[model samples]
Target: MASRLFKRPWTRSNDGSEATTASRPETPDDDDFHDAEEAVLHPDAHEEGGLAFNNRELLESQRSAIYELIRDMGMKFLTGHINLINMSLPVKMFEPRSYLEKLTDVWVYPALLTKAASCTDPVERMRWTVTWFVAGLQHVFQSWRKPFNPLLGETYQASQPDGSTVQMEQISHHPPISAFQITGPGYLFVGHSQPEVTFRANAIKTTAKGMRMLHFADGTSIDIVYPAYYMRGILSGTPRGEMVGTARFTDATHGLVCDVTFGKADGAAPSDRLLNRSDTCTATLCQLDRTNLASAQANSSASADASQERGWSKRLGGLTGRLTSLSLINRADNGLPEGSQVIGRGLGNWLSYFEWDHHRYWSIGESHATLWQPDPAALPSDCRFREDLVALRAGDVKQSQVLKEQLEVRQRQDAKLRKP
Candidate 1:
């Protein structure tokens, strides 16, 4: 069977931005508003000393007026077809359980809602849906940026059983500034702090023309460029752990490259220790571009929403689908090497709202560490052998004639023999 749902064609604006505003024209004047108010407040509006009838009458009047306005715009009634007015009315009447939940269910989650109702073309609908979802989410959540304290009442200075406090900041030239408590999946830390210091320096700014190198602050120097958003994720405790962050550095020509690396940070070492010493396990270098970042963020939001609604079966099927396509293309192009392992990491946890359940949290040791990799070679020779051994270790059986016979057979078997 074909898919039942579809996405609405997005209405694109002149400037290429997604257009989310309703197409319905506003009410002609204050006449409708005044009429509705009068209908509610009139003496006949009340019945049995209550204004229940009047309220209903007023609501009906308002609804009629809105419908009429929608009709005048050459569009169907506000409730006609799949317009914004129709989509929003149910949410207004019912009062969504949660704002985020409503957005997901009514707008973000339902791709078909837009596709089925949209007047625009499919390409436009896809583009507009993505833009609309991104803009709408940002508008709703960005304003609620109160400092989130995931670890309520958690102390920053945690004492281990040994009694030594985790040294958050070793000796640094920069004076310690503010500290905030943050908690992630596996680990919790009390006082996370960052210090900033400013030094006066001369710098040559980069332009489209060519490179201009400059220096200031005595020995301190930097090649000037547009500021970029920087992000870092760090894991640190008494025994060294992983830290990942974007770093800015220049080559011999003073061209800057932003390097993002994931690895362990040596707590014993100084703050300025070279990243290479800390086992630069994974690194990706992307040129600084705000537009690209914004686009990626938008796409990420859209994909995240879709991932949440997909069923387990569909998700698994999608994995096979992608693998088949890749295998075919790779074979034709001779792109991939022989015996290349397709290490597929499904976005299984993306369907969950809780960050702790996600792979990102698992990597950072936020919650319980989960086994991410399994070795097929580690399987026991016999399917029941591992379980039987475990059961024996758990005192399931003290002694058995069958177990003795199996051991004897194993000792004599050349295939099962191992060098001491």
Candidate 2:
């Protein structure tokens, strides 16, 4: 159905030759400047991507510093067995968020997909819906900090810009499960996810199992599932990760399904697998970087085939799938740059559409900083009420660690009381 529906429709002349179209350069209207103002320039253009000779050296040194961290990590992996929680890990590796906040990182982007959730056309909605899920692959190599596990019965809630709100609760401590539901005027989303944690010699693999069921105002429902994720270079090198599974979204009423493939198939040699080459982040970083760039192309036409794009729109076809292989969208099809024809029908700029930006590198930081209230609004039992969270966010690693262990101990005690 998608193959037939998403075929590029090209115009032809009387002679039957192919016709082409060009998008006018964006002309900003007064409302557009007032309206189109998305990112405020740092007041310096050259400072954006340009670099002086000395600055170039400094930047290279910075990357080299990060490169060294990878090498040192590899050396450490050569030592002893690292547990799933990495008890022996240097304190520097932990990013202070509770396990609950880390999972929220997974939910943030989906909330931005209200357009897809609210779409009336089932097919287009599925396309938008699944494409957005695949777009989550962008977070594959983000940061290496593993969040602390959430306590049983602990919960978190976030309201969306679309006037909708979603809540997640830690329903179990034994298997560590989180059940989330998004409710509002036009759509409803409910899902449960739990991870089976495993340790590879040089990496950590998380097999995430769950499905998010999206229901629309017209009774349309779509099931979205996320792919498995692995943290690479953890044991003996610079840590990174990538999305390595095939995710599917199936629409019940329409009998439609969209499958999105992310990351590369494992191609390590038998020896490479046994003796993890964690020293080099080269291969994984290369793949993740390319994936990231392609996703970035969706944000700016200048990064893509500019002649056809007129910026992302508010409609279904605006953000046409280009990066992650949209069985529903294409970039260069059959050796022909399907530029012009994909204009309005292409996948939208997911970043702008979902209002995601540089801060994604911070993951759940924005949610903790601005979205949730710490005092009166946050219950005494809320995670925001934890002093450890405050110390961690403030970069006080030692105090945060002390608080982390105390909280873990308390959780264990509470769990015992709940058992029959």
Candidate 3:
């Protein structure tokens, strides 16, 4: 039996509120709640590349805001490393034994900073960014007590004196300038350690102390010094330790404007053992700017042709040539010998000896042991030949005959004047 039952419809209040608002179970899927959370977490949720897409005006404003954020962040990250190294305690240690350990943790900052610059992952970037600044001061104590080997190659060996052999294995190709990045603004700290020595029979065995120069991103540089003396210790051990140098900032744009002097503690004292004290007066300017790579490439291509033309001009200008017979009769002062075989042996020697490219040396003997190194400074300055001098020195028969005829005219004038 079906029964008809009246059901009440949902009612709304007259206070202009949401009608029939469901008192649904509090679920996490509410649209208004989700939207509010998204707004709080990512305010630019609708933007692409951090720029608003709804309107041109909004996009312009977003772009400017984003750029400023990036610029401020980059500057802070870059300069933060410099400040951290400036205020470190291990850096203050003067003892040679503990120097290396003190600077061990210092490399973290630069390593992290370099990684941050290269990193693309946001998580890794954040980690490195934080690590870059927190890493404390770094002091690199270079031992002067250790023997330094100057590596030389075969080419260099052939040029140097006998018994002045260099240890080719020890030569390092790394430039000190690269370590500091002097091309940009930064600070550099250089440290010097005292010489350590050992007593050998009749000879004082000594190793020079080590010196290290630290370059910071900021312009400040610091230097530290350590004391080391070589004496027979209770045990036999090689004295190997580190030293520190001054700390100061240098402007990358202006470079070092003062003379930074470094010398041994004993003034002009010749000791194989390294000295302890040193001083610096900074004056030289170092600057780093963009190199014109394109212009340099262009110049390299035309350099060969330009060099050839210059060589031809120098050789031809030295040649002594005879004047045509027709001109000899017409012109009184032709400034040329009648007929002269240009003696260009000296010019040929000059050309043969001259090196267009000064980079390489010319082998002289068969074994090539003796090399004729070109000296551009030694080249003759008076390359142009005088016609009168050429006429007097002519050796060839045809050249002498032409010169005699020209000289006969001059002799006749002298004889006429003498007859009076």
lDDT of 2 by residue, 1-420 (tens): 010111112222335354431222334553322112132211111111110122344335444543465476674543444344424233344556666556655444544356676677675566556544534443433345556666677666666554566566666676666666667556777666677766545556787654456778887866565656665544332344455545555553454544444422144344322112221111100011333334333543443343235222111121122211122212111121222121111211111111111111111212221132223354455655567777878889788878778877887798788789
For residue 382, model 1's alpha carbon misses the true position, in angstroms, by 13
Q: Write the per-residue lDDT of candidate 3 for residues 144-234, one digit (tens) a residue.
A: 2211111111011111111111111111111100010111112223332232333332112333233333233532221122222222211
Residue 327, candidate 1: alpha-carbon lDDT: 16
Off by over 4 Å in 3: 1-109, 112-150, 154-245, 254-420
Each model's lDDT comes to 0.23, 0.44, 0.24
Candidates, ranked, lDDT: 2, 3, 1
Model 3 is weakest, by summed lDDT over 10 consecutive residues, at 346-355
- Give the worst 10-residue stretch by lDDT in candidate 2: 279-288
Q: Worst lDDT window (10 residues) for model 1? A: 348-357
What TM-score does each of the candidates earn?
A: 0.16, 0.55, 0.16
lDDT of 2 at 333: 18
46-158 in candidate 1: lDDT tens per residue? 11111112234434543454445455644333223322211212111222121211112211222222231242332222222222222221112111111111111111222
Instruction: Compare the candidates by TM-score and give the number of the best one.
Output: 2
